[model samples]
Target: MEDRRALATLPPLRGRVQQDAPLAPFTWFRVGGPAEWLVRPADVDDLLLLLRDLPESVPLSIIGAASNLIIRDGGVRGVVVRLGGKAFGEVSVDGDGIIAGAAALDAVVAEHAAATGLAGLEFLCGIPGAIGGAVAMNAGAYGSEVKDVLDWAEVATPAGVIRMAAQDFAFAYRKAVLPARGVVTRARFHARPGDAAAISTRMAEIRAAREATQPVRARTGGSTFKNPPGAKAWALVDAAGCRGLVRGGAQVSEKHTNFLLNLGGATAADIEGLGEEMRARVLATSGVSLEWEIKRIGEVTP
Candidate 1:
């Protein structure tokens, strides 16, 4: 284990640092345990100083809104950084381009751009994540992905901060091949102009589609599995008769088979166990191996 004492004595550091911070409040599922040390950096300077001074042995995990994550019940070790305040949530429009801080909500940025009659970012209206997460996951909806509109991003590297162009980010279907240790601080997007009414209509349609097909009302980490090539994960799960299946408090969503819902009080192990079962059955029945879309971190209870 790393030294918790050092973190405690590191002055104010301009941001609040809490010991054993409950993670359930931060995550969408509302089921995770605590983070050993949760640090909300007030600004980039605060973050850089903390990172520079912290011992290399002490690990750090960066999270945005926690929409596509599963923090296990045993809690995460080391420091968990969640950027906050005006510095990390700023969004500004410069002509046809938009600059957003890491903590800016995707929906907020999309609405702002849309209000300005920008069209390219309408797809982001349906994504429930922060700008950093949207950039990291290459998050998409309907037909457009973040890669289509992203101009560049600013990242905090071990050596220092650096700006990376869109081409510099190795973007795959739903993955960004940035260094695991790199922390994204801000991003820029290039959106084109379109009729604001049309964009709003399209956003509404997307929201309705999600409501009809996903368990959006339930505690969940969006889709549990990614669609494999040539087949949709949800269709495969439904075909395998996994829909509405329950294991403890975790249930394979009746609305969307690929989504696992925390009906009320589900533990991380229960959800993971149900996921394993779904995978096994899907493989046995359809000969297709489903890959998880949601990132799982931390540990499970013994």
Candidate 2:
């Protein structure tokens, strides 16, 4: 009775269920094993029904457009809930506010806002994750962040649907301390009126900046480590001579040491090992410990 085959015993779901689904294709790192059980709920109602009846002992995990994650080589256990479909991809303009489904891509949200002459969300165009993941982590870039624009978010929790504000989450510097077991479903962000042309121009600049600084085309786990306090993570990594450092099929990006890249055929172990080595090197040289920004999930291959 392996976990992959255990999904059949769970309470009935109103969504598609796949056992032993390969997870590598869903991640930016593109290097992981399978999910023991992957569930994509058709809509919020469907998701809520499933969550309400789900066994308390069964683990629940959610992934968005799926960046900033490392699904280990031995695959995940329990249910990996991915919010998708029309129910989770809609973007609407509510006055000066933009309401987006959690599954909507950050880039798409940016585009929707810009198209509606909203200015504050231009930074989202540069983020690779979807709104669900973005909301979960208070994802940000350049000088702007989600907390600045987020009015409230709809999440499914054990107590049923709840509206959580930025203050509720205590959002700070790429961190959002959400309620345990809550799943973000939708978000409403407040934006100011601006010239559509100006917003588009700003988005273009941000995208261009990312292209110049990051190894955008490579299979990478976005930023491997968060900036340690006042020190830039990349500078410390470079000072430690870790730029372009290689481990198995993974390498620290020459273009951006902050990012760990799969140079092709790298396993989850190789990538994680390289990141740990970076942390050690940086700590030894800078006396400052780097913290992982990427969420590493699942089991390691023995």
Candidate 3:
């Protein structure tokens, strides 16, 4: 009853809203339950309006491409916002700078930068998910991270949209401290003049490396664990004999032990449980506890 009243009081916006929307299709693993409420605002203004007016009591969650995420079986409660479409997926170049909407794919942004002869963002080509998620997590690859190129980002909070400098994010390995309930709208990245062909070649090399070593075509979340200090997560997992380890329908990718795959018909529980098993094995063997890089959310089946 309270949920109905909250829904009725939601501010009208030029966006799509749904109740009990299936969220599996939104993720790379293609496993998960529904969202209690899913909102996709048409533009930044619409987003701001929603943020400003949403009841403080209502739970709000945000998702990007869900490349490195696991949403559990019992579904997420309250509202879940996913930014997309031209309003949040545009990528453009301004001189040596690239401006990308939060929803723009990291690879797309890298391509746009390459087309504009900007070189610094080539690393983005290897990172999965959207700019928003990249910025939030300091996503990196090929010895480069978002912090290396990000100049500033615009985030919409309940108060208003605020432009924050990259340093203000206090970026650390695979993490950033964003404002409470703030949604990244877009970001500006600093780049430099470079040979487009060379940049493209480098991106291609990274792509080839990923395809050869990782499960690029599998139903997998990106890297499952953070590389512990002075140690690669994959190497540790392999050393612990966790390569291709299976639990139910989920398995550690034989190609890359750091990744977890849903081998068709896998539930979220199966995938997560497999990851836990891998962690236990690594800890018992190497005495190095692994931290998850993939974000997990929602409730488990009761």
Candidate 4:
């Protein structure tokens, strides 16, 4: 049983809080058990204060849109912080720069930038995650990545709120080397100007390309694993004879081998088990290890 003593003393929050909330409602996969305490912060200040005041023993996990996440079936203990409403979904454009709140969707950012004739963020149109997630994972598509245009990002740390320059967060393929204690709140990106018609055309082309190749419409996380140097993970998986492979109700996507699809009634364990099986098979056949791109959180049911 969760103790409500700590929460009772804190002043009322601008956001909503629910005890024993079902997490599946917030995730794209529509799977997962309940969160012990689910809190949606109204803004950056709300989030920081909540984090600062919460007891050290109470665990906290920050989630953006749950686009690349899998919360296990046994459920997450302690608190789950999700940024909500306009406080964390603002997007603004100034001159050659774009400012986005952490909870803003990547597709919305892309559209906003493209409307202003910004060229670089067109790649974001193909990504289906929040700005914070894009920052955390260095999400990318086509030939561009978030790191390429990122000027700076604002993050809340255990110490305090800090503005971190792009260099401060060392970035690599689909990963950021921020201090493990940091959590992003917002980001600023700079892009070159382009013809409005051309930008729109490019975004449409990218969207079409993704639809043609990926299971974009399905209830699934984007990619399962990153491609190793000079090799594609999907090809390795396909070569391992795992294409259209099934484990319980989860299956390797027929459209894209790197994608794993939940064919209704699938559990997180089933999905993760299939992913592990694919990795093991691929390693055995290709002599190379695959790294999971999808972030897994919470405990597995025993």
Better by TM-score, candidate 2 or 1: 2
lDDT of 2 by residue, 113-219 (tens): 99989889999999999998998999999898899999999999866889987789899888898776889999999999999888889999999999999999999
* Candidates sorted by lDDT, best first: 3, 2, 4, 1
What is the C-alpha RMSD, rounded to one decimal, of candidate 4?
1.6
Question: Which structure is stronger by lDDT: 1 or 2?
Answer: 2
For TM-score, candidate 3 versus 4, the one ahead is: 3
Stretches of candidate 3 off by over 4 Å are: none
Off by over 4 Å in 1: 5-12
Q: How many backbone clashes does candidate 2 have?
A: 0
TM-score for all predictions?
0.95, 0.96, 0.98, 0.96
Q: Which model, 3 or 4, shows the larger lDDT?
A: 3
Model 3 scores a TM of 0.98
Sorted on TM-score, best first, the list reads 3, 2, 4, 1
Per-prediction backbone clash count: 0, 0, 0, 0
Clashing pairs in 3: none
CA lDDT, every model vs. true structure: 0.86, 0.89, 0.93, 0.87
